[model samples]
Target: MGLVAINLLGGVLASLAFAFVELRPSLPFLFLTTLLVGLILGGWAATSSPLAKLYGGALTTFLILFGTGLSPLPASTPESFSTRIGFVLFALAYTLCMTALLWRAGRAAENSRMA
Candidate 1:
């Protein structure tokens, strides 16, 4: 929990710094940064953990992106109901992909620690 909080706060700070540097970053750039940074932060948190708590890393990252306005910002809202649902599904897929990557890194870290 402490690790999650730390990463969350750090992510917020990083987002703030990014905003300061680029007052109007392109949507694609923002998304690229968000995903790349999120993965890095997630992996770092996993490595720091004494245990491979993948859920914690994923939850922390999802919250961090949400809190920092990194998610749902790169794209505008669609008018159709189905489109909205599609967007939501896309977000869910993004989270799942992130979790899968982080889980692998966390599992490796856990294995290394046991050796």
Candidate 2:
């Protein structure tokens, strides 16, 4: 519960920072931010109970996907084919990293509980 609260607070801070910063056309910064956010949330979810982890993981994944999909391009400007492909690849890589972090954290939490 404490972990979740901290994660949520961090997320709020990140969102405010992003909102104030001028990130237009800054693909690299956006990508890095998303990666960081996903990893933090994933790690937090891993520390939760099994059922909470499942929901947290799913919600985190969805938010990551949705945010990345919408952040880079304006609605008025239709994304080019290559740009779409790039977003897909970036999302895939982000997902994999988040999964790995969650897995490691979960294993550590479980082992500690057993001990």
Global lDDT of each candidate: 0.54, 0.54
Worst 10 residues of 1 by lDDT: 76-85
Candidate 1 TM-score, C-alpha based = 0.35
lDDT of 2 at 1: 41
State residue 34's C-alpha deviation in candidate 2, in Å: 0.3
> What is the C-alpha lDDT profile of model 1 across 2-106, one tens digit per residue?
444444455444545355436666767767766766666566667756644543554464454444443345554222322433444566667768888999999
Q: Which window of 10 residues has the lowest lDDT sum in candidate 2?
A: 76-85
Listed per candidate, the RMSD to the true structure in angstroms reads: 13.0, 13.3
For each candidate, give its TM-score against the true structure. 0.35, 0.35
Q: Mind giving the per-residue lDDT tens digits that candidate 2 earns over 2-49?
A: 344434444444444355334463778657665666676677677756
